[model samples]
Target: MTAIRANSLRNGPDEQGRFGIYGGRFVAETLMPLILDLEKAYRAAQVDPAFQAQVKDLGEHYTGRPSPLYFAERLTAQLGGARVYFKREELNHTGSHKLNNCIGQILLAQRMGKTRIIAETGAGQHGVATATVCARFGLPCTIFMGATDVKRQWPNVLRMKMLGAEVRPVTSGAGTLKDAMNEALRDWVTNVETTYYLIGTAAGPHPYPEMVRNFQSVIGEEIKAQFFEAEGKLPDAVVACVGGGSNAIGTFHAFLDDPSVRLYGAEAGGHGIDVENGHAASMTGGRPGVLHGNRTYLLQDADGQILEGHSISAGLDYPGVGPEHSYLHDTKRVTYVPITDNEALEAFQLCTKLEGIIPALESAHGLAEVIKLAPTMKKDETIVLCLSGRGDKDVESVGRYLGLIE
Candidate 1:
């Protein structure tokens, strides 16, 4: 919908993979060779028509991409302000946008002759997506998940196992997403030759943030064309939830050069922003620090040690955000807002009742922001909210929250 740019949004991270002062390769020496190799492979893949054709074919048939951009007629009428559209990524295969990146990375892994696939997951969506791809390719797969996430996202854990991927629970450091990532990295270091570390989000070392963003950018690209076809104009604001920031970055990438299109990212404000250890709103409540291989805004203590992040949405309960988000925040290219667990829950139910769409809790954070922003805008203005995942994996958690289940 926004006026197209002559060049695609690809001039980020520079040659050294630094998005301003935020992103860079900050991993250990042992992983440097593998990282460099991955960079080379990715660059080659970028220019190879055969690689592009393979990825595109899989995206169309396997992942069911070009997900719809649907106008939320009921929600728009109820809000009585701006028109709201839902970018239905939740409708994609594996029940989330995670599959898009997984499909791309798996193709790269195959091309690189990697025999094993390893990944880390928070809410289990990424793990399930990775496992699904591995199953399709008949490649051995292993997933590292935080002990806490293993308990909370049991459905996804079961899904991963059913897909024939081994799930390893990580117990270090709060036993959450960050710990799972640490364990995954250690595994990559140990088996770099045989294994391809399939990172879930748009974070990690050089190439990863860039690679994931490029894969996930399909969401924004589709939205741009679909919205233009439907409404003849770009939405005034685009919104998505930020954890490791894949979905947010993807949804915002195509519109970066469109000055009139504002971008909003909703972060997890667990209990309340004021409460210590209560939220995962990294950009809003945290300072920049190094974590998980890149320098980014992180929830940390006075000694610079990382702190545990809290959130009802397992996917969003991370201490640090992707480095590109840090750069965007620093430059005020995107406005970051915090949405509490209660607010997200309320919005989750509201969307379900109004539109018959049950969004993942991670996505509900964005819905929460949409609820806040929609009422303040003029009726002619529009907002496009990225519904990043479905809520089937989270039904049990929601039932427990509502005291409808034990």
Candidate 2:
């Protein structure tokens, strides 16, 4: 393996947690001290051997670390070009990469003596993951989900309740991920003394954006090791779907400094990026702005008011993207693209049929981009897509959309 370059792209957020012009703690004054305390606690835990040990142990025994990196033989032949591989995060406990961050944050909460946990989820994978860890640790968890998501992602809502989490459906604005986040932040600010907001993605305030990325970085680390074992070298590319961009940042973190590995992030292009309020492709269709405690690309109007973003996959409809993604786009280190709803739906069926692996609709966005990209590369080249979640939670909604169910 080659050593990381001297001026590595992996080093970021600086001291104030600003990644270039993006990412910073822009929040209400009432929440400042709480954010600071969380930052301090996180820093101390970063070097605490016992804390790190607990995270590692839980990941291995509970969440199932070292998710496989499997070569997609049929997919490669179908593409008729670059070899395709999948980093099977869907096989992890709770069926998504969300569990990786949830496990670490729950441990941190325990260390901080937090008794109540709260979170915001779009696709509901993060909510279920958070609720699962809370049940294991015996802490009360409250999840805020957009009303639309609560209706569409009922399976996950049921799973969270089964794990003992109270699901609060937010109805304001678009009834989507952005509104759910607003409610979560309000709850955090109101109950700052007793509550810990376990953010589900690599976005939000200073410490959260960086902290979540650190926790999820295991995906990329494991991918590199597993790929070396299988192919004896680095992959030519890495791809992932980006909502608030947790999984994308997770798998991209380890490859940021590798000049040879091209990184691609697929955003939800609901209908199309050009269609007003018809897509959630913040990076591709929106511009820089602040929302949910950080500066990033957001879908907004001329007055700078946040606009409702759309996506068939509930998770990828957030109006703003993770701040790190904004920085990556500006630096030209990663290519950000949009995948329309129809394209994603087609890719969803293709993957399930060809691989017998049902992918979350959110994951299908990444696969959709891979379908377009893989065929363009050399046959000797290799590409690994982060299959972020399984499709069980999405089967019902997708079935309705596909006209397979009444």
Candidate 3:
């Protein structure tokens, strides 16, 4: 066990948005004015009581705040060591924690008087969440998705369409999340005046990683209160799967000041880290580089070209992670582990059978880590992992993988 350390880990992302050389406003000069405007608007919103009230009200009513913290009795017994608990973000509206960021951003966009909206999605949960909010707010929206993801994640594509968002399949390199983000950035650059780019993850230019994390921090805030109410103390560990690290940072931020609580982030290892470019475990097998906007760990070749990392979960297919995650990883505030597709698959079935809860493949990666570490800890210790999203969107892809369907 680690001893309690001093200094608050929560106060991060200093003035220029650099999280200890990990994050910054690394964007084109053409976008500087727009980025600055966004930063100003976000800063103003931070101190506005009315804005905060609206965000909280929508969170509670529209997106369903305070998602239950359910004790996983069967899972705990099966692991036979640490007690297990699930922070049920999958029960939120749009079937994932993505809505938490979407709700706050959409409201912020309204405050800025932006009428058109656009976003990029990997596994489609973010697209669905963005589209759902745009529809609720009566804004015209478009979503960029990789062609590969558009096919594998057809159900989510349909969900976005049903919510009245135009889906554009990006057929660029890898045709995955990175490509989708590239396309989204291009759209933002072209239509910066009236279009509000709603980045789905916390890996974009300055203010975005910071803004999204602030909105999603509600996850940890509620977990703190709920866990205290249930067990009268904090969880020994807090774990979540990391794509661009929004959910992981959200769950880790509240307890940053409480050094006694250990934090873990599970990254997608499509096959294994030993297999070059075969995994999406950025922190485990990546070098620091700039991608999208901020400087962070990126899957890149020796020549500095970004590599296409593989993962069974489309949501975890990103080549880079959020900058704060990079800082956390460097500072040893959070332990990062790579979970292969096979491991996630096994963990998915185990959780489904034992707890009767089908988790998103992204969530499954975190579950895989929990399953491994839980059995090694004392029986009284507690481990709480984020059930980031429900498994409904992934049933078809998983069924095909297991040969349960044609």
What TM-score fits each model?
Answer: 0.98, 0.98, 0.98
Give lDDT per model, in order.
0.94, 0.94, 0.93
| Best-performing candidate as measured by TM-score | 2
Which ten contiguous residues of candidate 2 have the minimum total lDDT? Answer: 1-10
Q: In the order shown, what is each candidate's alpha-carbon RMSD?
A: 1.7, 1.1, 2.3
**Using alpha carbons, what is the TM-score of model 1?**
0.98
lDDT of 1 by residue, 222-292 (tens): 99999999889888999999999999999999988887999999999999889998999999999999988
Ranking by lDDT: 1, 2, 3
Candidate 2, superposed: residue stretches over 4 Å from native: 1-6
Record all residue pairs in model 1 with backbone atoms less than 3 Å apart, i.e. clashing. Answer: none
- Return the lDDT, model 2, position 143: 97
